[model samples]
Target: MGVVINQSIKNTIITYLGFGLGAINTLFLFTRFLSDEYFGLITYILSTANILMPLMAFGVNNTIIKFYSTFRTRQSQNTFLTLILFLPLVIIIPFGTIGYFAFDAISTWIANDNALVKEYVWLIYISAVIFAYFEVFYSWAKVQMQSVFGNFMKEVFHRLATMFLLFLLYLEVITVDELILLIVIMYVIRTCIMMVYAFSVKRPTLKFTKLAKLSDILKYTTLIIVAGSVANIILEIDKFMIGFYNILENVAYYSVAIYIASVVGVPSRAMHQITNPLTAKYLNERDKVSLKELYQKSSLNLFIISGFIYLLIVLNINELYKLIPEQFGSGILVVFLIGLAKLFDNLLGNNNSILFNSDYYRIVLIQGIFLAIISVLLNIYFIPHYGLNGAAYATFISVFLYNIIKVSFVYRKFGILPFSENTLKVSILIFISTMAFYFWDFSFYPIMNIGLKSLIIGLVYGGICYYFNLSEEITKLLNKILKRT
Candidate 1:
């Protein structure tokens, strides 16, 4: 628990710092320096690549975390690592070959509505390969009980690199093409660094000995590809579909709105870093007592934290949009819709961790494939009609439904719920806080207004949670902070 708290706080800080840099790049730099078409093209390229990442990864990342603790001997661990390390190529080689042979048709299909993306089809493949291995190595390190460095590499390094490239673009030192190209190179370098760090943490000998559970592992890895894709598709398919249906700039608009709303997910991102491996451990050990406690506390903490973030984003969305360019301002409704969906996501706590790690992953994963199909259909119908808002509508509905399925499944199988009396308490507090603080603002510039309003909101929110002891862990941490001050 101490390790979870310590690393979660660090990861939270790092993740927020990265998000801050991303905000600058997305809201100010990209909109100011890059044309909406180019921004949308870049977003489309990355989102498409991300959708392919799970397939390229072949689910090695999740497999590593889930299975690593079960292997007791060094030899077996080495055997396990060796298998997963090369498992991705099973998909990558054939997939890449087909992509090469049929690049024209595939790129044409993806770039159907937006031709600007055709030339960048190769970049999408390269980026997906890079993204896959990065997660593979990140997981390698995670099973070593070391995640901070990888978290920094995951969250901060790439964005900071992109920020530098954006500045170079601003200075006329690089063309947009060069900036995009350099960004791919930046990710390659980031992944290589993570690979090195992973080995530094645990350079398990690469042995080719047959793993004891090769059949089970390969089966899980293959199934998890669809499962992982279910998540990525839910997250990024909106942008991919937007690019498919409309011109590229709509993706930029949708990307901006979703990016703002994504801030609401930062706490979950932070805590999941440590909690995931821990949850895997508990599940592997079949420690229901520990699992239940973690499930609820993580939910409570993330709900409390994300609920506050949700309020900030939804309440201040109008003022927040004032700083961005006018053309990109069409996503205010997009932000609101997606913001609520992300709040629902946080409310699930460790639901994702538990489900993915449990024996029932197979059934839930199959269900996820259906939901992925549903998401695509929703996007197909909505994006053509409502444009950016249409995409948001599809995403909000898909994510909300997906979360609902995951929670219900976890409860029905495990007979445990993530919610508690405090969850209801936090829900009420969030509702009251939103109504009280919203529809009112300081008479100041957008930044000043956001900061002042957020400060008051934070103090009030934190004060209420602390005073009521809604979360003993959080309350204790707050007590420590108060004592230090």
Candidate 2:
């Protein structure tokens, strides 16, 4: 338990360091340094690549994590590893071939009026290939509990490359077209780095072992592909639909808002990296005690952490948006909606990991498919009428309901719930803190004014948390820091 907690904490700190860099690059530098149209184009291209990745990878990444524990010997694991490593190419080839044939039509449809977008659509496709394969390689590291390297490479390295590209663009060393080209090249480099790290962690032998269960592996991979696509649609279709119904500038606003919302989920991501493999191994052994403990603790910890971050963001949102361009200030509603959705997601914690790795995972596929349908319908009905705000509303409602359904399903099947008196107390504390922080206005100068107010609010909030013992771990850490100071 100590090691698990420590490793999770370390991974989370590292992740946030990366996220801090990314937040600056995405929200501040990108908007300040580039035109909104160009920023929108960048986000839209990444979103498109995200939408395509699950299909291109054929869900082999997920299959790797779920099945890797079943092979007992190192040799068997290596063989199984090799199978997933190269298997996606079999499907990717056909998909890429089909994409090549219809490239112009699809490109025309997605970017109907934007010449810049049409020119860069193929770059995004090339990016999707790299992104998909790198994920497969990263999953190989994840199942072995080697997440820090992959997480660093993923959360840090990619953004660093983008930052350099932004600098190049700012200096006029790269034209808009060159910047777009560099984006594709960065993905290629990032993917290659991850592949190198994957082999360094555990070398996948090329020795062809006669495995009779190829059909079973393929079937599982196919099912997960359906499941993965459904999940991806729920997460991304809102952004795509927003771009479709509105314009690139709308996407720029929505993307910044989503970036704000995504910070709250960082804990969930860090915890999942550690817990997912554990859950898979535990479920295989039917270790209900440890599994249940992991689920509950994960939920409680994430809720506490996410609650703090959410409160901070909501309270300081007015000030934070002031740091960006005036056009982006309209994204406040989008931020609140998406932030609430992310909070709901964080509260579920390892519920996703437990379910996805369990024998009852097919239920996940069913729920995901249902959520995908709901998300698409909501986007269709709302985006035309409400624009980006409508997209946010649709996302909030769909994701909120999707998580609720998953929680209910897990409870019915496992008789485990991820809530307690402490959770309720934290919720109440969050509400009170947010309300108090909202009404108090402070005006100083520039962005430093925002930073100062945030510091004061955070200190007061920390005092309240410590006084009430909202989280023993947090309280203890704060006490230690205070004492040292």
TM-score to true structure, per model: 0.99, 0.95
Cα RMSD, model 1? 0.9
Per residue, candidate 1 scores C-alpha lDDT tens digits across 191-287 of: 9999999999998698997689888888889899989999999999999988887578898998999999999999999999999999999999999
Worst 10 residues of 2 by lDDT: 441-450
Clashes (backbone N, CA, C under 3 Å), per candidate, total: 0, 0
Model 2 CA RMSD to the hidden true structure, in angstroms? 1.8
Which ranges in model 2 have alpha carbons more than 4 Å from their true place? 212-216, 472-485
Candidate 1 yields a Cα-based lDDT of 0.92
Model 2 C-alpha lDDT per residue in residues 1-485, reported as the tens digit of each score: 45567668878988898889889898888998888888888888888888888888988998888888888887788788888888888778987787799998988888876787887778767877888998898898888788888888878887888888888888988887788788788888888889998888888787469764677678778878877788678788887777665388888888999999889888888878878888888887889999888877788778988888898788888878877889988889988998988888988878877777776777788888888899999999988888888899899988888889889988999898988777898788788888887877676654776677678877776677789887666777778878999
